[model samples]
Target: IIGCSIAFNLAKLGAKNVVLLEKEKMTGMGSTAKCSGGIRQQFISPANILLSIESIKIFKNWQDEFPYPVQYALDFRQAGYLFLLHSKSQIENFQKQMALQKKLGVVTVGFVNTHEISTALPYLNISGIVAGVFCASDGVADPASCCAEYEKQAKMMGVQFLTDVKVSDIGANGTTRRKIEVVFTNKGSMLTPCVINAAGPHAAQIGKMLNIEIPIICHRHQTIATPPIKWMKKNDPFVIDYDDYAGQEFYFRPEAGNENTGYQLLLGGHEDGKIQIADPDKYKEKIDQDFILYLADRAMNRFKEGENIQILTKSGIAGLYESTPDALPILGKTEEVEGFILANGFSGHGFMHSPIIGKIIAEIALSGRSSFDITGLGLDNFKTNTRPPAEKAIV
Candidate 1:
């Protein structure tokens, strides 16, 4: 999705000869397809918040940008995001985060006490929840559809796409110290002055071609979809049980609606405090039995209706998240290579941040810098040991 968005934004910026390559047989078969599709501005970092704000501008009014009669629809729903706070420390931390968000012009987000939460979502148990930070503007959308539209518009603007093509190596002109001259692929080689590495999980492998070490690791994230619940509403806000009581932190949101079967619910998040590093080529594509049991227990504890519904183990899907140490995407041009740019290590927010990342990458490629300040998102932060605090507001 980030690659397609970058191509689209490049074409939109009047750049000619833009080409997008995908390793998969079709686009969006990677993390974009497996994502939870939650878009939010309730982040601890300013860069992440700004990215969400800018991307939400397009997501909120996708039709204004894509127009109607198009093949793809985002299926966007602004049902909001509610982060349940349990501990006093959690409440205080969120209070600080809310203040930061308000300072950053995220005025629509506010704190909702337990009473308000219970009033709004009576289905919740609310046994230990003290408060919640709700952002009505932050919601869910169809990532696959959005990526498809981006590809379509980019193609309309003369951006070429090559699917099922694998990049083997990157070659630099011998005369220059660090300048990419050709991209070697399985099909053939293409001469290009610049290359943007948006290669999600395999980004680090791609960086090695130019001797640029990209610090990213792939973690397997599993999600389960429950059978249609009769009481489930189509407009329920995405709920996050942020407290880690008994080492269980879970979240749920109404899945795509169905008239015949009612509404299905997508449930995920039961951190076991172990990083399950995954090989991009080989990893379990199904949820673990233990995790499934954990989610079932979480569901029963959080909601009154959870006991009646059965958790479908077969309905689970898993994917990889390319995460960095700081939980922020590495963007902008690199000093090690003149024409090489970094758009990798989005953690798990790639789909949500695609729009703004595309624009920022285009700005850097066309000009020298972006209008939005990405000073803190550069790879240099790691080299200087000045990386910002890791994001704590992540689900």
Candidate 2:
């Protein structure tokens, strides 16, 4: 979505001959299609909070700005996100984090006590819950629909998309690195001044084609859905029970409708550890039912209402989290490669931050630098001598 959005914005700005290349037979067939589609501005870092705020604005008014329909109305309910806290120490920590978030101009985040949480979510069995944080602007959307819309809008704006054409290699020219030439499968070759690595799981490998070592790894996440239940509402926000013993193991929310059509649940188990894979094609897609049961057990312990829910479907996908040394993204340019730009490592927040990233990358590609200052996300931050602190609100 970020790549297509950037391409669309570039073409809209009168940049002629803009082309997009995809390795698959269709666009958004990769990890993008498997995202949970959660958009939240309740982050601990200032940069991420700002980016999410700006992206939410674009998502809210996409139809007004773009001529074509982006199919964004996949039940964007702002019922508010609730993060549970079981321990007193965790509650204090959340209070500090909420304070930082509020100081950074995040108006929707606030600390809520146990009584407030019980009153807000009557269905939840908050036996051990003490306090929590709520962010009204944090919500969910349909990932597949959003990605398709971006591609559709980009196509309408005269951007040529070449599917099933894998980028074989990229060749750079000039002694001081002035231009880049990309070689793809069916399209033959094309010379451009810039290239953006939005390849998701294969981003690090794409950087390796130019001998640049990007610190990113692939992680597998599983999601399940339940059969229709009467108590669940369609407009309920994405819920996170932070008090799980497994450490942020699960998240649940309504699918799209309110006629008791069931709810969708996403689980990231503690036992389902991340595995390092060099090739994207070698990923495993089959989900472990045992892991799902483990996560479901943890979730049911918190929300007793879930124990009787019937699971309708369960599936897994291989998506790259693209973790940095500090779990943040490496955006901007690298000193080792001249024309090579870095935009990979999003840690799992790529979808939520796609709009801001697209705009910033477009500005950098067209005008040689981003209007928004990205010095904190520079590639040199991972050079061992100067590493940035890890942002604490990644869950």
Candidate 3:
């Protein structure tokens, strides 16, 4: 999605030539295809909140913006995100985050007591939850479909996509030293002044090729799906509980398949003390049993209906996250390399913020400036040893 969106926007904005290269056979076959597709603006940090707000606006009007009735239907829902707070400390933390969000014009976020949560969601067992934070505009969508839409538009606008191709080297002509003169791929070489490293979990490898260190590593995040249930609440939100054992996360969203399937859920969360993998292409793709049991046990404890949550399918997806130290993305051109824009390291929020970042990257690739002010959120900040606020909400 990142590569396609960047190329799409660049072509849309009248770039003379644009090309996207993908090692995988299909577009979005990387982390984007495996994403759970949650979109929210209830972020704690300033850059995240600002970027998410703008991205959600684009998602809200995505269908109308494209208007390809057959090829561009966005299966998006505004069901919101309900963060289940388990303690006074968590509530206090949410209050602080909520205040910051409101200050940043996110008035849709509000706090509701645990007692009120029962009234809103009678199915949820709220004994452990002390309070809740909810945002109506925060929602979910089909990211793989969105990626295909961007690829289609970009291709129509004359952006060439070379699939099953590997980037071997990235270097600038020694004479100029200001632009990426050519890109060496497995198939052949291409000359381009600009190159975007949107390689997802394999982004670090790309940086290594350019002799620039992108502080991102691949970590496996697994997910599971449950069988269809007969009963469900109206307008049920994606619920996340952060105070479970081992700081374990349990997040699930409503996913409906065919009519016979009734109502189902797509659930997953991060396990405590995750290890970084050296390679995204070689890591385990199967979901582990221990993590599955951990998530299902928490689900059954939190909701009465969760006891009936049977494994709908044996298949599950384990996506690799291109994580950073601060859990924030690295954007903009770096001092180490000129004309080589770093658009990787989104940790796990890449899909949700793809819309705005595409625009920002488009602006940067064209005129060397971002439309949205993200100077503090760039690699430059890290170069100065700035201690930016850590993003707490990643579930």
What lDDT score goes with residue 298 in model 2? 67
lDDT tens per residue, model 2, 340-392: 77777777788888877877877777777887777678777777455456766
lDDT, model 1: 0.87
Worst 10 residues of 1 by lDDT: 61-70
Model 2 C-alpha lDDT versus the unseen true structure: 0.71
The TM-score, computed over Cα atoms with residue i paired to residue i, of candidate 3 is 0.95
Which pairs of residues clash in candidate 1, taking residues 3 or more apart in a chain or in different chains? none
Which candidate's TM-score is highest? Answer: 1
Of 1 and 3, the candidate ahead on lDDT is 1
Task: Name the regions of candidate 1 deviating beyond 4 angstroms.
Answer: 66-69, 174-176, 245-247, 259-261
lDDT of 3 by residue, 1-395 (tens): 89888988898789967889998788999999789888888888888899889998889888554524438556778889999887888888889999999999888899888777888878788877778999988898889888998899888888899999999998775544556788998999988877888898988888888777888878888888876765553247888877744566888877766555556778888777654464776887888787777778877987787777787547577888888888888888877667899898888899999988888999998999987987666776787877368787777
* Residue 273 of model 3, lDDT score: 69
Off by over 4 Å in 3: 67-70, 175-178, 244-246, 258-261, 274-278
User: On TM-score, who's better, 2 or 3?
Assistant: 3
